[model samples]
Target: MFKGLKPIQYAGREVWPLIEGGKGVSATNHASSGAWAAAGGIGTVSAVNADSYDEDGNVIPQVYEGRTRTDRHQELIDYAIEGAVAQVERAHEIAGGKGAININVLWEMGGAEAVLQGVLERTKGKVAGVTCGAGMPYRLSEIAKQYGVYYLPIVSSGRAFRALWKRAYHKVPELLGAVVYEDPWLAGGHNGLSNAEDPTKPEDPFPRVKQLREMMRKEGISDDIPIVMAGGVWFLRDWNDWIDNDDLGKIAFQYGTRPLLTKESPIPDIWKDELTKIEEGDVLLHKFSPTGFYSSAVKNPFLRSLQGRSERQIPFSTEKAGEHTHQLDVGVKGKNFWVAAGDLLRAREWDGQGFTTALKTPDNTLVFVTPEERAMIRKDQADCMGCLSHCAFSSWKDHDNYSTGRLADPRSFCIQKSLQNIAHGADPHENLMFAGHAAYNFKTDPFYSNGFVPSVKELVDRILTGD
Candidate 1:
């Protein structure tokens, strides 16, 4: 029997199957989350460097005044805690006891555990659940249990869930709220694409999530436990068979891209305008993140620049051997290095075109760049703030003498700088715009045909009619 989408118990309150996925750098803020909660759905507050407001509700820029990289890292932690606390407080007031609020964090972010503990301790009884992803978050359950809040671990495959359940999540099953299976190929933001998986080949999430449910059921978890499907979900009618199917068990849908156009969305007006104009394939999935993970972003000029940089790369050998016939003309010539004969002409052309500096990557390849670009890359690397547990860009590990013992990678960029700039009204084309593949639908969706931006309540109502 089809009863349509209805409310269900989540973290102590009955709420709709709808959930607003958390976006970092103040994209999902208090006003937007509060409005979602008021609409009888779970709202997520992004605890990843959330922004704090001034007395007049203006966003206060996060300026670092520290003299050292480690000092700046501490400043970042303080900012994360204070901003998350403020957002949670506002969300609680706006909810007015109607719906629940969940805090979202990335396990790979620098000082993730410390930020979670700090925010949870300060905002007692305010947050209902914690959603975490972007690495094996084994300690997430334990931390949530300590604070008496539900925990949702986001994974891309069944093997990941089985591993987490066998290791730590099984020990704290009471507060386990839901399992979020984010599609690696189609999802926005940081993807969980494993080594065995091909990024170019996308898989259907139906079978993947069903297998996850089977694994959970085998682990003694009830069928009532909802599996929230995130990434590439736009219309509920498109997923009719998944709603009440006995095989998939209880289900929910989460939207990270749809809410960006809503009235309460905190992003700049330029971002909203740009979203409407985005075409299919404008968003790209690439490996440019310093966290050594695959992430999806708009293929704007900023992303294109990175792609061009990688294209200019070529493999080289320290000494000439079999098939290593051409001498590297752009680099130290007397070093006995060799490159492919075909690449020698290209390298010479690039060098003649003022791209005189060559930087070596961890993969034993050399990337040629202009002197000015080379200087900028070095400066950005020197200003590393330890934003990730381990960064491939600056080679700054949070611990172990604060170095990964590897050369800084030029293929990746500092995510913190770009996200912050974009969130605070910078150019979207110049920043990394994370979005699901279905984001292109905004152009044709009748609801947004006439430049109409719905309120959170309006969006929820529209979603309820199965439109």
Candidate 2:
């Protein structure tokens, strides 16, 4: 159907019209990417925390004892590199004789160089390209050139693209394969929010993609440099104007969420079913992450917990003399609970809602909840053998000097622990499932066959042909 489209040369290999966006954890694994590449398109295997598994599919021992975030982050990177190498080898074997395989990297994640180096060394020339996001990857071109691989940076705006071009594109122009313009609001995972951009404002991605093409041209990058459009892209018919058009320049569509419903996608069935049944407005962009960035996901029971917590919170200040000394006594004798008026009222509300139980700590801090909830929290904490450097769930830390410093925050849960659980078919309601806003279309889309999952080739054909 897209016969007029010419094959673009990237990393010295030709690829088809499709480009699969890299998903984190085991979501976007080698099997899925290899299937996409086997269809003559580009497949990106997510390498974030890539070295998470050992040769026997078991999690390797993490060296970080929660002492230092920096030290823990480094250890995580080493493990990620090892894991990525294993994934690449598996993907190459599956690619068989189709298109090429690419590795996806998060710039903000630690051990970017080490992970890439390990994968490249193991795969040798089998690795075709590297796609990076999460931050401005200014050194991508330089790194890609060293290994004779193509580099594509994911950006949300033309200005961001130009900044990278002026700094690095001038030197390794050939290494630049394409510019991926991911819709910050529509795509899943972490979004690229500008300082001035409002989260409520829904910006049209078509104009932005065109704007990026013009900016690339101004920077000496030609029309030949493809612009891969991601996020909210479901059907080619919705973007017919972009294809075979001179004004928009050469373009390709990147799918991040839709691919999850395909047979080759590694997401658990529970996750796919949730995406299939999601309502139009169910996905929300939230700011609860410690990374201080907005993340997109379904507004399920998991998200409701965070929302409820946010709504009940009230600001407390010890500024005024009269406001500083007032305290109310509640909970057990040894564990006394002292809280502001607002906190008491919220606790009462929770108590009335069957979450009855209150405890006062030796430090005079008050926490309210049910005995069952407390037991579950304790179980979750006990199960945590130190996933993150200093988890808020178990209060585990790598260092000893700091209280909350060395201890995990009781308020926050371990993301890795919960996400891994959900990814492996655990109860979806108990864990967070991140997805793009376009996930709702799966319900009505005829191509999905009422959530009857198709293979990667079938899904890609539907996207290209608009069936």
Highest lDDT scorer: 1
Worst 10 residues of 2 by lDDT: 328-337
Off by over 4 Å in 2: 2-6, 51-75, 319-325, 328-344, 351-413
Tell me the deviation in Å of residue 36 in model 2.
Answer: 0.4
| Cα lDDT of model 1 by residue, 97-204, tens digit | 987899999999998999999999999999999999999999999999999999999999999999999999999999999999999998899999999999999999
Relative to the true structure, how large is the alpha-carbon lDDT of every model?
0.90, 0.73
Candidate 2 TM-score, C-alpha based: 0.83
How far is 325's C-alpha from truth in model 1 (Å)?
3.3
